[model samples]
Target: MKRRAQGALEYLFMIAAALIIIFLAVRYLTRTSSTATDLGNSTLENITQELENAGF
Candidate 1:
């Protein structure tokens, strides 16, 4: 009975660790995506302004 409880506890720990890793990965991806989108938008706006100034 003691061995069974130990095994169950280990399983729970593994599951918890996996969840934490997955959460961190998702968060990192979301931040990276947001930063890329913002950079692209800023670049586009700068180009548009330049073209307008140049009479294009």
Candidate 2:
């Protein structure tokens, strides 16, 4: 009985740790993607302005 309890606890701990890692990874990915999108938008705006100024 004691062994079974210990095994269950270990499994629970591993699962919790895995969940935390997954959450952090997802958060990081979302932040990175948003930053990339913002950068792309700014770059596009700059290009448009430059082109308009050059009468293109």
TM values, all candidates: 0.98, 0.96
- Clash count of each predicted structure: 0, 0
lDDT of 1: 1.00
Q: Which stretches of candidate 1 lie over 4 Å from their true place?
A: none
In TM-score terms, candidate 2 sits at 0.96
Off by over 4 Å in 2: none
Shift of residue 16 alpha carbon in model 1, Å: 0.3
lDDT of 2: 1.00
Model 1 C-alpha lDDT per residue in residues 1-56, reported as the tens digit of each score:
99999999999999999999999999999999999999999999999999999999
Please list the Cα RMSD from the true structure of every candidate, rounded to 1 decimal place: 0.4, 0.5
Give lDDT: candidate 2, residue 56: 100
lDDT of each: 1.00, 1.00
> How would you encode candidate 2's per-residue C-alpha lDDT over 1-56 as one tens digit per residue?
99999999999999999999999999999999999999999999999999999999
Q: Please state the error at residue 47 of candidate 2 in Å.
A: 0.1
